[model samples]
Target: MDLQAAEKRTKELHNLLNKYNYEYHVLDNPSVPDAEYDALLKELVDLEETFPALKTSDSPSQRVGGEILDMFQKVQHHSPMLSLGNAFNEADLRDFDRKVRQAIGDSFSYVCELKIDGLAVSLRYVDGLFELGATRGDGTTGEDITANLRTIRSIPLRLNEQVSIEVRGEAFMPKKSFEALNKAKDENGEEPFANPRNAAAGSLRQLDPRIAASRNLDIFLYAIGDPGETGVRSHSQGLDLLDDLGFKTNKERQRCASIEDVLQYVEGWQEKRPHLPYEIDGIVIKVDSLEQQDELGTTAKSPRWAIAYKFPAEEVVTKLLNIELSVGRTGVLTPTALLEPVKVAGTTVKRASLHNEDLIREKDIKIGDSVVVKKAGDIIPEVVNVLVERRTGEEVDFLMPTHCPECESELVRIEGEVALRCINPKCPAQIREGLIHFVSRNAMNIDGLGERVVSQLFQEKLIEDVADLYKLTYEQLISLERMGEKSVANLLNAINASKSNSLERLLFGLGIRHVGSKAAKTIAMEFGNMDKLANATREDLTAINEIGDKMADSIVAFFEQEEAAELIQELKDSGVNMEYTGARPVAAEESDSVFAGKTIVLTGKLEQLSRNEAKEQIELLGGKITGSVSKKTDIVIAGEDAGSKLTKAEQLGIEIWDEEKLLEELKG
Candidate 1:
């Protein structure tokens, strides 16, 4: 076809595919068959490839992913993403309604929306085209995840209205997607994500947008970034505007005329929540009128105009049949309660993490005793308390193990930690756990080599260490039970791919006592390579900001070990890249921006930048980012809903910058 013909065809195809995507993903009504969509998308892809210059950022083909980003840049939100105060019971709801009525008079209604248990994000559009997308990082500054956000088909690449606006939404994974992901993870021998919310977050955080596209993430836009920009007076009207602009807003939202209606809505959802495709922790109740919301105003951390009515945790009484102990990669002995199967939060409760012996003793948990079990954070099953009053005399006090359950190594407590540890480096359990951690998603990310495969390899004596993973022959792998030629090939390919991972991944995968992923990344960037990191002194290591004595000591000790030295050499021989290849942070020495050489803490909901965005900008200006306020803080940037951090800054007499001031400074 001619260039002009191709251009016209590409535009037509883009429009057709986008409409189909909106119909299937946003409206849940597909007018076109899967084949039809695929055929058109294929044509668009071919055309874009033929005329690469014709490709635009908002093109349908971009949804498949464009480039692998070295790191996510920060994107400031146009408005602050404020969190809402929570109401736990009927009284709290009633009080909230009463307060709203008192402030705005009797002439107001409310919009109740399902508070989806997912990551909050902001979407910005310019001239009806999707421009930037970000996370609700600290409500002010957020990471630029536009590439990943584009993969979410429900989020329109171009709005129906040609208006510049920003919208807030909950990006979520449906129950089916969550289940499918977990099932895939389990099949691949990887650890399953605890909840859909976490799964969604993890997927979006991937540096490679293609990974996020594979996760089936969706969004439900609820509020406009600036309601006045859209000329919407009420929350319900704003939602309508969102829907009309080709955005997917939650249809479950309802207009509550009274507190009784709000309560009824909350109560109705509580029982039906489990049946929904996506998880929701609570219902968000907002004062309907924008005028009323302005009058009601906001508190230090949340909006007084809106409150989240959180669902009470579902708890159940179950019998503690036995106590089991397990050894971790760090040799920490973890105790678990083996409980009689009971239902809690729609899942069967068979076991719960005891955390440590102290928690077990504090709860006075005994075998054969009735105990209250609940899912903490609606994810981790935990023993809430022992039903001491109902405990039978037959119940026996549980005893803590004096040795590692797997290797019988003496358990010793570390100087500052509560859990008992096994100092024996040769413990089989620790070796197996270390191997599992090495191949985990955040580490080397060796797919097809999951915990099950690692365990099998360990038990069969095919692999003893992570370095041994590279030594496995195809014949050896093919001989294992259930290992077909195709499976073995995939495993080998994944193992080969992991060898190219950057230095930080290797450092984290080593399972160093105190060196987490963040610290590893910091150290990796500072040193540039394994050889330099290995040769660094404890004092030299500790000199880096955020690197404390414990972490420095751990790094020094890890490098000092003869075995670690041998392992490093072995990994090198196996062709593993040991240099830091990821994006490096802007150092104070390299920047001369106003924020240079200053410690900054961001608190409250920022109207313009998400917390991460502000932090990135501050860092770009050579400022250091710290989580909390202290005497060390040079400046505190307070946004809307500034909380304790702001108060602490005032107490410390630290310089405070409001959103307007910070933005002005940034502009200057």
Candidate 2:
């Protein structure tokens, strides 16, 4: 076909596909069947491949994703993405209403929206064409994630009208999408995300846009960045304008004329929340009038005109059937409460971590007692407290086992520690747990080596240690239950691939005491090889920043063990790469940069750079970024609305630099 015909057909296809996508994803109504949409999409792809120039940024084909990005660039939001103050109960909501009435004389209404449990993002459009999308990193500055955001089908690539605008929204993974993603992860022996919010955030932050596309993300545009530009008089109108412009807005939002009406709406939703496909942690109440919002104004961190009424954690009473003890990779005996199955926070709870014996004693928890259970942060199930009033005389006091349940070794509490630990090196439970840890996502990252498969391997005596994993043959694996020819091949390939991982993976997989993933990377980067790290003295280990005396002692102790040496030899004999392969950190003394040898702490919102960008630049110049304010901190880079960290630094007489000053120094 000619260029003109191709361009015309491409535009037609874009309109059709976008219309179908809007119906299917945003409106939850598809005009065409999946097969029809797929065929049309295929045709569009073919046309784009044949006539590349016809493919524009707004083309429906862009939703499939683009080239992988090395890193996300920093973006400055037009206006700060201010957070909202939270109202935990009805009293707090009334207090907020009182404050609003005092400012606006009770003349304003409120727009109540479901507080979507997802990542907050900013979308920008120039002349009604999608331009850029960013994260709400520190409010003032954010990371440019346009490529990833384009993959969400609900997000319109082009507006209905030719107008420049910016909007704020929640980018979310629906409950169904999150379930499917977790299911896939579980099948691949990967750790599933704790919640939909985490899954959405992880998906959007992926370096490859294709990964985000595969996550089945959705969005709800809530507010206009500059409502005045669109001539929208109220927040409710802004949402309507977003809908008119072909943007997805939450239809459940209501403009309440009175706080009583708002309270009723909030109450109604609390009961209906779980039935929805998406998660909402709270209800956001915003004064409807733009003028009233401006009058009420904002504080340093959050808008005073708006408040989020968080749902109280749903608590349920369940009988604690028994307490089960399990040994961890570190040999600590952790007690878990086995409870009668009860639903809390949208999921069923069968067991909750008791943490240690101390917690059990402190809570006065006993077997067969009625316990109040709740999900902490709406994710982890925990026994909030014992329902003493509901408990019967039949309740029995639980006792801590004197010996390890799996190994029968005597349990001893380490000095300065609360939990009882089994110190036996040859404990089967510890060995099994260690093997599982060794092949975890952050460790060796063996794809097909899940807990079940590892247990089977251990039980069969085909693999006793992490090193034995590399020695597995296809024939042996194929004989195991659920291990077909393809599955065995994939497992063997995954095992072989893990052998070539950098020294950090190997070091972390080893389960050395006090050496976490970050510490392992630092140690590996410093020594460059396993043999050098094995030979390093306590003092040698301690010389590195972030490696304290305790960690150094632990490292020295770990390497000095005869079994550790033997394990290393076995791994080496299995053709495992022992050298660090990641980028090396620059030596502090090597550069004359101002940041060299300085320990810096970043606080609050940076206007010019994303937190990561600033951190990368600082580290590149040999400065270390620590999380807290301390006497050890050489400098504090204070950004807008700097908080407790800045005050602490000031009290400590630590040198402080504003974002401007920091930027000046960086430029120099």
Candidate 3:
């Protein structure tokens, strides 16, 4: 094909695919089947391959994300992505109403819109074309995710208005997309995302935008960041402007003249939320007048001018037929309230988290009590209230055992800790839980291993600890009940593959207290390997910023055990990524380490490394990359706006750099 013809064909294919993506994801109205969409996408890929030079980086093919990034690059937001104040109950909502009334004197109306259950993102348009998009990191700064954001068809790459403006929106993975993604992950021996929010967040963070594109994310524009040049008088007007600008604003938005109308709107959605395509966490009620919003201002965490009236967690009553305590990988005692099966938020709730002993006492919960249960954030189910009035005298007051219910070990509640823990490293329950976690998708991510399979392995004496999982034979696995030959082969393949997961994943799967994924990643990058990390003192750990004292103590305690030592040796022998070969000196020791003390600000989109890769590069150079642009920044890898940081860097005379310059330095 000729150059012009190919270019036109590319545009045509992109538009067609984007339209189908919108219908399936944004509109929940799929005109073409998934198979048809995939076929068109395949054709687009073939065409792009044939005319590789004609393909733009923002083309839909770039979404799936690139190689696993070692760290995330930091970008300062052009505008502060402020959070909204929350109202948990009716009284809280009334108080917010009173505050708004006090400020505007009941004359100003409010715009009530659904508070979407998704990550907040800010998009910048320069001369009516999408230039950048980012997360709501630290409010003042975020990661530049323009490449990923452009993949969302609902988000127009080029606006009709020739204006520079920033728009705030919620980036969410549609329920159907989430389900499909999770299903695929499950089949691929990967860990499934817990919810749509997690799925969306993870997908967008991928270095390759193609991964994000494949996830079928959609968004709803809510607020206009730069009202400059646009003569908008009210929040409602701002919504109109966004809609006119070809942004997908929520249809549930309403203009309520009084607080009563606002309350009615919130009440109506309490039941109507489930009918929507995406998840709505609550209702955001904002003072409509732009002038009034300025007067009301904000608190440190959220804006006072707007308040989110959160719906009470959707609740349904179920009988607490049994109270079961299970030991976690970290040896914490978790009580599960096995309930009489009931439906909540489209899923059947057979069990709910009983929290800890304090929760049981506070709720005055007992065996035989009918309890109210609901899914928090349409995810984990938990008991909300106990039906004390419905309790017959025959109902027994449940006493949470002071011992490890599984291994009879004495339980101890550490100060400032809510959980009653079984500190015995060798406790059977703890070992079982640890094994489960180790093989879990998020951690080692071994495939074909569910709780049932793990239990069967243990019962049949084929496995004991997590290490035993790797030693299992296909023959032994096939012998287990219902383990078909194909299933066993797939399971074995997954177990074999998990021997080399990155150090961060292995650390988090270990289930150390106060050590979440972010913490684990930080530690993995800092120590570079398990051996050094295991040997580090509390002071050494505390020196790294973001690692708190509690976490340091937990690390100290975890590594002190003989079992931890044994596990480490076993994992090393099993060929896990046991050392820090990847997280150091970006230029193979050729460049001086002066970049160590100098932080760089990443702005705009880079075709090279992802935000995560950029952050890792800076860190490896013995330097730090902070999310915000500050006087301390040595250089700003200015991409697009670079926002306030670019302005601040200019003001501070900090060395400014771009993605190409940084890449060139790395190559050196």
Candidate 4:
């Protein structure tokens, strides 16, 4: 298409996408299939690539996210996004009601709704289009996550009305989506998200919008940031406006005429919550009238206008039948409790993490012991306490293995840590673990290769070390049990693709002691090359910010070993990136002024720059991009219907800039 035609088409695509995004995210009514939406997006990408000048910040393609920012920008809200006081039970609710009645001395009504178990956010709109999004940071400032917010299809890109407004709500993962995400994580050999809250928070905070998009996030607008400004007189009126403006709001809201009715609503949900598709931690009871809300006002941290009536924690009892052990990719032995099947938090509890030998001994737990199990943080099954009085004589103490359970190598407890590891680098279990770690999602992120497949590969001796992964053949893979030709080909393709991974990934995959993803990134950038890092003294290594005494010692020890040195050399020889360059930013020395000490949050899209480029620009300007919004934010760069973050920023009276304005700042 010609430039003019391309520009016109891009504009048309933007409008169409905006309507669909609003319909789906805010209205919960999808007008198109996901596949259809994806196809349109692909077309837009192609058009933009062919005619770069035709792109704009509002384009749907720009929502995939940008590079990591050195800092988060601070944004002050127009009004404080006050926290709600919590009511643990009916007594607390009655107390709140009594306090409200005493304060006003008039008959009052309330709106009772589900308190979604998710991260709180604020969204701001100008002229009916989303302009900014931010977190509820300290009820004052917040982080900007425009790009990440755009990836949430449930979030409207535009509003139904032109009035500038702020809405506060929750960003959440539905129960079904949470389960699917956790299952996918488990299958990918990654740690499952602990709960719906964590899952939502983690997904929203991802630097990559693609990662956030994959998690299936949803949101619900609860209240307007400035209800009086919107000409809405009550909490119920705000919900009506939110609904009319195509904003997604929870449907379980009720107008309560009395405190008794509010209590009834809360009690009803306590039993009905499990049947809902999304997680509801409690019930939020709000004074219905804006006049009442203002009269009620707030405390330093919470609103007298609102209260979260919380439910009792979910816990169940089960018997510990036996202790089981699993070998990690690093050959670290972890003990787990095999329990008699019992229901806890709506799921059957058959096992729980014992943490380690120390925990088992400290707790004095044994087989045949009755244990109280609760979903720790409402996600992972955990043994909270042992019912010592119920323990029978049949219970047996679990002994820590003297050797590696898988390879039978003598185990040694590493000093200053809980893990007992097999020092044998060449041990089959260790090798398999190393390979799995190398290909894990947080490491090289090799798709299609799972733990079971890696185990089969090891058992068949088709490969060794991470380097061997690049050398696999279809014939060898197809020979394994349950391996079809297509599966084998896909695995090989994923391995081949992984060869292009940057230096940070290689560093993480090496699995050095006292090293994590953050540490690996720092080390990779500091030394610039694997060989240089290997030769660097502990003092030299500790000079980096994330590097410390324990980490340096571990890194030095890892490099000092001949086997590790050989493995590094082998990986280098096999085409893994051993030098850092692809995405490292210049030192804090590089451009340090107007942007200095500034924290900015980027949300939605910037048509003129890649997400990475935007991040680098912000850092170069001496600004930091924080993962979440908080009181420390300086500015929020927003795009589209930015959701609760924008609401938060407005509530805090934070200044917001659009993509066009942000681009100008970066360019200047």
Local accuracy by lDDT, each model: 0.86, 0.88, 0.77, 0.78
The regions of model 1 sitting more than 4 angstroms off are 316-320, 323-337, 340-372, 375-668
**lDDT for predicted candidate 2 compared with the true structure:** 0.88
lDDT tens string, model 1, 1-668? 88999989988998898899987787665555565887788889889889887798888888866678999898788889999888999999999888888888888898999999999999999999999999999888999999999999999999887999999999999987897776444323344576788999999999999899888899999999889877888889999899899999886778888889999989888866764668899999998899888888887788889999999978999899999988877677778899999998878989997867877777788889999999855667988888889966999988887877888878887765667888898999989999999999889999898889999999999988999999999999999998999999999999999898999999999988767677788889889999999999999997786677767888899899999999999999999999999855566768767787788878778887877678767777777776556566789999876755687789789999989999988886
Q: TM-score winner among the candidates?
A: 4
125-177 in candidate 3: lDDT tens per residue?
A: 88877788889998999988877787787887656467789889999987767
Off by over 4 Å in 4: 316-322, 326-335, 339-350, 353-372, 376-380, 384-668
Cα lDDT tens digits for candidate 2, 413-482: 7765677888898888989999999999989999999999999999899988998999999889999999
Query: Higher-lDDT candidate among 3 and 4?
Result: 4
RMSD of each: 21.2, 22.5, 19.8, 16.9
Query: Which sequence of candidate numbers ranks them by lDDT, best first?
Result: 2, 1, 4, 3
Q: How many collisions per candidate?
A: 15, 0, 19, 63
- Model 1 quality (TM-score): 0.55
lDDT of 1 at 547: 78
